[model samples]
Target: MWSGDELDLDAYLARIGYDIERDGELAPDLRTLTALHRAHASAIPFENLDVALGRPIPLDLKSLQAKLVERRRGGYCYEQNSLLAAALERIGFHVAGRGARNRSRGAALPPVTHALLVVTVEGEQWLADVGFGWQGPLEPVPLRDGVRVEQDGWTFGIGVEDDGIHVLRSLRATGWMDVYAFSPQTYQPGDFTVLNHYSSSHPQSRFLGQVVAQRPGMDVRRSLLRETLSLVRADGSVEERIVTADELAATLEAEFGIELDAEERAGLERVHAAGV
Candidate 1:
């Protein structure tokens, strides 16, 4: 059960472009679940701008709602998945908060650095994640072994190993690659606070010294780093280029829908301060 008076379901639904509803309750079915997942992926971008800005990442629900929903900004895994978990709980879905280590960042043993949700609806479990950086699944994938789900020409598969699940993504020419692995035994609610601190401040954290952004639009999916911009076309072809530092703000505003305010613009300079 959700721990608040009530979640602003209406606002959340609208934020993600979910219109259909069931009187008072959000249905816990595959259609509704997938719609919500897809809408969120298309709407809210996955970004780590706040970390670069030296902003304190509050794990509270109110802060998440304000930043992600009201302010129309995006965040990394902890913020994104937390907001989704709350909404799913209010909608009567059984939600479990889980953490993972990004293999892309170089998988280490006993990892705990990412956030995701395992939602049980109608006795079936689905992996729901809205904050995974580029190549993340756009739809909720079944938590079953050997099943492949496609999202925007990319494919994802889950394999059960050693009491946990390993998420794999198709690499076009290289075949499947390990994305991340997670198990309940390794994840604790307390882990997020510790991980959040490290991810937000530690110099070695990938988010600390870079500007990363991603979001999928009607015709294409856009992604960016400090200087690189990549667009995945509908035909599965990718166009990539290197943009100047001066062009980053405009690109964020125009492509990712994040218009950096004066404070945010000032924060851009701090990315260089990190790792020093």
Candidate 2:
């Protein structure tokens, strides 16, 4: 169970720009779930600057609220999904955690390093993830196998393999490409803590020595990996350019909506320069 009672519900709703008066009453229904999921995904970015900065990534509700909600910053899967799980639970929805393997990198069998959520509404389960970076879902995708949903212009589908592992795929120009896959096993916060350690600190972790930030939108998706900034449009067009250390701070704020403080900016700049 996520620690929902300890979260600042008002601040979180406000941070995501979800006004109860305008959006709708807070209820544990599909409408409310989709609205909140979309709002959160569009509002918060996905970044691993803390990992690159050599800072500890805490999973507690208070720390999550302080660093993500209050600070208006972004985080990777664990932090983003954990914060969302708390908010949804606080709103009276049934939420559970799941571990997933990264499949974007072709032919590589990585460990289960991704943390996502499965929310039940009216006895139906939905895959709600706000932390998959640029390839994440804007709204919850139903858990039904072979179900496909379109959000704005992007399309996502869910399929079950012979081993009973559910895979989430996206429709690229080439075809349906695997995004990530997870089993039916339910993971706990402590489980994510273990996974987070490897992701944030392990030398082989992709986030350890690089600056990564991503924002997924209806028209375009932006990704800042180290010094290269890439933009992919809905029509399958791609544009990329290198970002210098001098432009790192501005690029983060402008492209990914992540505004780092003085110390973080300096540290990230150094990491970017070294990585380049």
Candidate 3:
């Protein structure tokens, strides 16, 4: 594991509302790793606001830290996982960046658009992802078959596919859904640059106007689409509403803790318009 020469470990820990000293169990154990994962998933959010507003999403470390950590913003898979991997490395954890495809059971697999972390702690490999918009496991789960992990009302498991294990999540409608599939090959920063650009700029991309944001919580999971705002309780019950255009910014701030700047606010307006 490498140190954070350019990355600010303290600021990142503070941003995620995590105190390393309080954990008292460092050295990359499963307990501390789970703490870090839960804290990050709850505090920070998964958002595509920049894509909605037609802004560039850069993959550089400084740009990611400045936007997510300093500016108090959230990002999609590429940006969010990149920041988490850096912070994990700073804390002396063995983190490797891995890419996964948003896949289905029998359909042809799409490109590798999702970025996640394979962290090795105490000689055990754990899958760590904080940016999946849909709710999933709150803590790091072993990358093995039949390992069930539950967070709030959501249930997740790693399925042993022929190629490798696939991350799966369960809900009321679909019993289990395959979110993505990944291999052990570590991906480089350059691989994500192309994916981020395509995800952000492609006219037909889902991120263009299909607003998706989430802030996972212990008791409730708050999420937002272009117009709908959902509050899912711990009992698997959901209460949701269609947020008006005028209320989008405030909903984002109050519910998801995302305070948008002028550009982002205007960008949200554009996103809502295109949908209508």
Candidate 4:
């Protein structure tokens, strides 16, 4: 199942700032699921810095723990969700993987490059994903079609198409916007490895040459793509500005909570100076 036994559950709990003594014991229940999901989403950011630095993205549990939990760094989909899946599984939840197409980009059909999790609690399924940068749900969304849930001020819903694909949508100012869609077919860890290879290394992959980091919050969402940093509020207002190489590291740390070492900071600055 997601190599749950190998994960250091206590370390992960601490990383996400979840306190068992204060909150409660970890159990395979909805309350525990939602608490962990929200905490993980808020604590770990979503970033593709390693890919931008031309580093290999490893999906092993040990590597994920070392890079994300121990290093206090962020990662893109596979790394984020894989770590989450492991933690949830270790807590006795039934977690399964699913591959999704990126519909947020536009009408053009993108390949299935995103990885998410479906966890079953007391025979009910929940769509649990902490990887989808700014547009992701803060907590697990019910897998039922037409079910809508609001977290703080943001609203998200699930819809089923004629083909039986479940589409996750967010209620934007314009209207309901599709975030991403996935089928009923469950994916495996090996399947995510294949997708991760393409996303981390393929020349056409958007993560390859640019710096991308995102943090989602209740009232505001921040996104840094290459040199541009954009902040979008729940009311549809957006403020965007270009970030120079000199400000990249500080911006990441200040806005996304991503701390980079001297080498990473120097390398990313070079890339930012060159532009995407």
Model 4's alpha-carbon lDDT is 0.93
lDDT of 4 by residue, 15-93 (tens): 9999999989989999999999999999999999999899999999999999999999999999999999999888899
Better of 1 and 4 by TM-score: 4
Model 1 agreement with the true structure over 115-173: per-residue lDDT tens digits: 78888888988888888866678889998888887776777788878756566544544
Clashing pairs in 1: none
Give a tens-digit lDDT track for model 3, residues 61-162: 899989999999999988988888877887788888788877643477677777788889888889999877656557887887888777666777787777
Question: What TM-score do all the candidates reach, one by one?
Answer: 0.88, 0.99, 0.90, 0.98
Q: Kindly report which residue stretches of model 2 are placed more than 4 angstroms away from their true locations once superposed.
A: none
Clashes of each: 0, 0, 0, 0
Segments in model 1 whose C-alpha atoms lie over 4 Å from true places: 1-6, 21-25, 105-110, 186-189, 216-219, 233-236, 269-276
Off by over 4 Å in 4: none
Model with the higher lDDT, candidate 1 or 2: 2
Worst ten-residue run, lDDT, model 4?
267-276
**Candidates 1 and 2, the one with greater TM-score:** 2
Q: Give the TM-score of candidate 1.
A: 0.88
